[model samples]
Target: MKVPETALPDERPNTGARPVDYDAELRLHNRAFRHACAILARERVLDIGCGAGQTTRDAARAASAGSAMGIDTSSSMIARARELAAAEDVRNVRFELGDAQTHSFPPQGFDVAISRFGTMFFADPIAAFRNIRGALADDGRLIMMVWQALEANEWSLAIQGDRPQSSAAFSLADPSLAKKILDAAGFADATFQDVHEPVYYGDSVEAALAWIGQFQATREALRSLDAAAVERERTRLREAVAQHHRDDGVWFDSRAWIISARCR
Candidate 1:
């Protein structure tokens, strides 16, 4: 399936979306989700925006009786994911490069469709959701997780100090907007729930800063700033995260929406 080009312009920064090394954090999120929701063991599943294919591979392993496929727009991510799957010797999982926002799926193909921190950048939320719904079988389910809001997510808020607030335009951060878009997309039984999770950066704060600095959007914002300015922003982020530090380590007070619905 091909992703429509229409929904990308709004979210695409001057530099395209880049590959991120969130391997550990992603695994953690996956584990937490498994705890919260019933695993689709033995159920055919499609993972949209499946970066690195960890979740897809995990699903295939955990649900050995089922088949799993992962799709993403980034070739680098897809390639890396394939390598990871091969290394892990996961035979039932496969990765492909595709646009999830507009990809066409076979009728009654997937029992479950899921995404993690994906779908947040969709330029057209309604259209994106509508296309996703087409991938599922009758009464199939959709499960996705996205940032709740800038204010509630200390990690995003810490990183985005003066960046323009998205309150004006359509944003996935707002749970209300999520419900609205899902409803408009013809899905039923929409629900949103809060999830608090820890994103361990490193042994120290500096390591965490270095890792997060690779974000394309965040880097673009720092492009115009002088070294002093960039450091100032880093200091602010450090202090913000420090508030959440404990004996275990520093953890950002992150928030996400666990949105679910079923196709009619």
Candidate 2:
């Protein structure tokens, strides 16, 4: 199951270089994996949107006799995943770059499917889950994490302000809606468990401001406002970060749903 080396750009999507948000978000996702690993059957596992393959490698280790496959749309992520797997000498894991919505996964090949805050961005969630169902063995488990409502997640609220509609992270925020979509996608017993955690943004206000400013959309949204208004917004954000500052770093509350279902 050893995979070959792949080249990546200077930065990857799920890496710390991309955004500090990803760092905290990744913690949430990986934390969910610890709970989801209970379903591993040591047959075969597939990690959808497996950014850097840490969870994929973990699954591979859990399924020592089997194999793990990590697939993501970003080639950089896939490449970095391969590098991590190689650096760890992980032979039972592989990474591929492909879109989960239409990727040609093997028929009934996986015993369990896992994702970490990765399945929410699909243009057609039902179609994507249906395709994922096709990749699983009969009655295989689908364990993944999606965000709760925008208002529930403090970090999202702080950064998003009045513009929470831009990101697809909250698409599955509603439990009933998520269950309905999964049911339509040929999955059964969709469940959402509330997971409250704190997301680390930065060690200082300057650091947090720098990281938060990386969000170009926020800048774009504020472009129409006069300089004073923009400064006021910036000051608002800085004060918000300062309120959450701690000895270790800046942390904010976040809420997520640990969704689990079975392929029907």
Candidate 3:
């Protein structure tokens, strides 16, 4: 399905530019993540690295009487998340600017912790997951949606063809590695469910270009090129993106893993 645009107005002063909707590219993934979460009523949820609070707000809406709190390292993102939550009148959710790895969460405070493509960037995965486990109640759930191997995701290949892939985003692509980390972090019975879906880029080629151009990989690649080479790369990228445009939107095939575990 064509995901509706959830881009909110940028309230930041002096920028005079509409903030890029980072969530647009992952709306379909978010739908699947939400479905996999299946948050229960009265379950206090902690959302790690929740950009703009989209998932946190969804959890709050689902939990109804319960509450959701989102934590992120970006101050701007947290501010924007708060604004969106307030604007949407979602009173059961809140956002905080903090890193999950070292943030001191209230002990045994949350019933569940969730992340959407957010857990892979930790400088120390074991320490981060251990910290998260400390915040959960006995047998509290940990659910996350993470990308699979780079070879399995067409979206990454389309955006970054033949480039050396060193991104931390793919750190947990291996189930064995993920399970080991969880095991050391006091989690047990970890399971991974495969999720195949098309990630939406935008409604048109131009829109897709605008969105993809802001990617770190795109910027780094373009920054290393000479003027003519930069233009050539842009042309190539434009063509690659154009190949994915259709009547619905610019879509790319993606594969992810829905990982679920319980605190031991």
Candidate achieving the largest lDDT? 3
Clash count of each predicted structure: 0, 0, 0
| Residue-by-residue lDDT tens digits, candidate 2, 53-162 | 87788888888888999999989888989998999999989998999999999999898888887899999998999999989988788989878888788877887676
Q: How far out, in Å, is residue 132 in model 3?
A: 0.1
Give lDDT: candidate 3, residue 247.
Answer: 90
lDDT of 2: 0.78
All-Cα superposition RMSD per candidate: 7.8, 6.7, 5.7
In order of TM-score, best first, we have: 3, 2, 1
Model 2, position 133, has a per-residue lDDT of 90
User: Highest TM-score, which number?
Assistant: 3
> Across residues 1-264, which tens digit of lDDT does each residue of candidate 1 receive?
222232111122212222225776554566766554454568888888889887788778866888888999999999999999999899988887888777777767788888877677776778888888887887788888777767876666666777765542226767666778888886888787777776765444444554456656566666767888876766776666556656654567677777888886
Candidate 2, residue 3: CA error in Å? 34
Question: Which residue segments of model 1 deviate by more than 4 Å?
Answer: 1-20, 166-170, 234-247
Error of 1 at 17 (Å): 26
Residue pairs with clashing backbones, model 2? none
Using lDDT as the yardstick, the better of models 1 and 3 is: 3
TM-score of 1: 0.83
